[model samples]
Target: MAWAWLVSRAAALGSGASGLAGRVWKIGADDPRRAVHGLKVGLALALVSVFYYTRPLYDGVGGAAMWAVMTVVVVFEYTVGGCVYKGFNRATATVSAGAVALGVHWIASKSGDRFEPVIRSGSLFLLAAAATFSRFIPTVKARFDYGVTIFILTYSLVAVSGYRVDALLAMAQQRISTVAIGISICLAVCVLICPVWAGQELHRLTARNMDKLAGAVEACVEGYFAEEE
Candidate 1:
């Protein structure tokens, strides 16, 4: 009987733990903010899909159009400011790097067709190595870190991939455009829909914490005096 009772208790405890674990996932699931975010995600996907399928808007871009949608997926944040910061970083990196890639391609092209591939490869390796070292610098990493990395890759594709295909400049341009479209979509949703701002929330939380700490100290002092009396 004791063994049976112990088993039953263990099973009850297991069930209780499982229920607690399940409830953890549901935290804030019913909150209006969560609902708004869900709606935004759905709407963004649907809207991008429309653009994805439309030939005129995405013509010649082919599957590359998905990169635009991918950017939106990765950059979208619950807060408007968060989304904007990330989107801006990505867009800046994409466009700035693309421009540099075009210039690099033009330079590398002058080195004869056979030598072009070798030059492009060497340049890619050097750029990647340089970008790695650059990213460790606090000041540079703050803004241009992503830009440096993307610049290397974009420069590589435009210069090296040219041997395999035509219109290297056009490909570079399309990629930049796709990234811009993605950033635009994310920013629009984050701002126009139930807008939230992380900076404001952070400030509010700091104030609440200060207020609570003050109240707790006051309560403790009152209790201490009461005990002395």
Candidate 2:
């Protein structure tokens, strides 16, 4: 059953990616909006690459710079609003989760390596169970779903990664910083560079549809009264 579910999820993701790739090349200058969005995507990725290559902050943020770069790739959207919403979600989720992970690592570190495996493994199970359960509640799930998801992932990484790395909290901190940086870059680029807003597009579409509907109704009413004239 689990294998079947995994396969189904993978297939869905692959299908969606293929569909987007197929449509991307079809975009042309006739629809400049698509071109603009494509440009934003490219620019965001370029910024990520620049940060990853340049160890501008060689202190604590260098090791996990790739995580920041990855965040930029995943967080950016065609619309400014979408980018903002997802950027906030990703950063909030990652930082909150990383804090918890760091706390667990600290406790394990003081206790010594004899109990490290047991402590880390136990924490992973407990955290995952609670988080997975919390995700079912409607209101809770809607807002902090990403947070819960990230918490689990971050905890697991810390648990396993601490075994090899002496500075578990340091790594987690670096990861959190990288995520913030990546999200900031994405938000800046999306807002400053020929910004497109989802809310504005939605309003425009709604207004246009209402106008079209009104025109159709007026035409129909006039035709119905023609016999009286």
Candidate 3:
């Protein structure tokens, strides 16, 4: 009975894998552009991974190289506009947050051990609350929502961790630099390699739709005149 149960589970898993493969193939077949996009992403990742694989590059950023990898993963988008938009927002947010955190860390450091924790905690709460609230504002939400979110995350991480970390400035700088590197790589890959422009795609789709609508109207008008005649 156990053997039979194991075999049944294996068969189910195999069927699931087959179905997944079929769906993947269908998606690629439906739009070859999607496959190209996937290749672009893989190429970008490989380019960024050099910071990890090369000794000189690894030494420069150290463990912070991982941030570059994460940046590539998060910032790379299907469209060039989207990728640039996200990359800019992330880099700006990280720098802004890191600077503010450094300032707060400095202030807290001078306040004596007893008050240091209090100051950091209070600042974290206030900044986080403010950032979260800003997300509700229409304009900010539309353009800068992702930036605000990154601000909150980066600020919280640096401010809270600064308490125990001696080289807070160095760490923040390394991370910011690595993030910039990643953004640069993503932009380069997205723009230079079989680039996908969102604006062009939208324009083409709109033109096609307009043509269809015009054809339909022309047919309707001809049918009406024929009926009258």
Candidate 4:
């Protein structure tokens, strides 16, 4: 009886696995574009991986090569517009935050040891608070919420780490460089291979809706004329 029960359980598991495979196949079959998007993403990742796989490139970035990978994963979107939007936000935020951090670090350093911690802490609190508050504004929230969030995060890390990390400038430069490399690869792939433009999609949708509305209006007018006749 126990042997029979075990066999039945194995059969059930096998059927479930087959069902899952079938569903996955159906999704790809229903929309070939999904498969194309997947391929594009894979290509972008492969291109970015060259930074780590090639000796010269790897040596240039050193351990920071992983930032390129992370940036690609985080910023890549299905549509070109989305990818560009996110990439621009990330790059701008990183640079701005890094600059501010460096400036603050310089100032704090010049203020002597006793006041350095106090200055750093005060700057952190004030900047973080202001960035957070900006999110509440409709215009800023709509267009730059992501950038602001990244700014807060990047600034906090640099400011906090500056306490112990003497080579803050080098560290920030490596990260920014890797991120830029990743963004460039992603944008290139998105634009060159199976390009999907969000603006085009929006245009198509708008035209379709306009056509439907026109047809509805024509039908209403025809009905009213026929009734008057």
Please give the clash total of every predicted structure, in order. Answer: 0, 0, 0, 0
Tens-digit lDDT track of model 1 for 159-181 = 66766767877777777778778
* Model 1 misplaced stretches (Cα beyond 4 Å): 1-26, 29-31
Which ten contiguous residues of candidate 3 have the minimum total lDDT? 192-201
Between prediction 2 and prediction 3, which has the larger lDDT?
Answer: 3
| Candidate 4 residue-wise lDDT at 25 | 94
Instruction: In model 2, state the lDDT of residue 32.
Output: 78
Q: Ranking under lDDT, best-scoring first? A: 3, 4, 2, 1
Q: Give the Cα error of residue 15 in candidate 4, in Å.
A: 2.9
For each candidate, give its TM-score against the true structure.
0.80, 0.78, 0.85, 0.83
| lDDT by residue for model 2 (178-200), tens | 88888888888889988887879
lDDT-best of 1 and 3:
3
Error of 2 at 126 (Å): 1.3
Q: Could you give the C-alpha RMSD of every candidate to the true structure, in order shown?
A: 3.9, 9.0, 4.0, 4.8
Angstrom error at residue 168, model 2: 1.5
Rank by TM-score, descending? 3, 4, 1, 2
lDDT of 3 by residue, 16-92 (tens): 99999999999999878899999999999999999999999999998899999999999999999999899989999
Clashes by residue pair, model 4: none
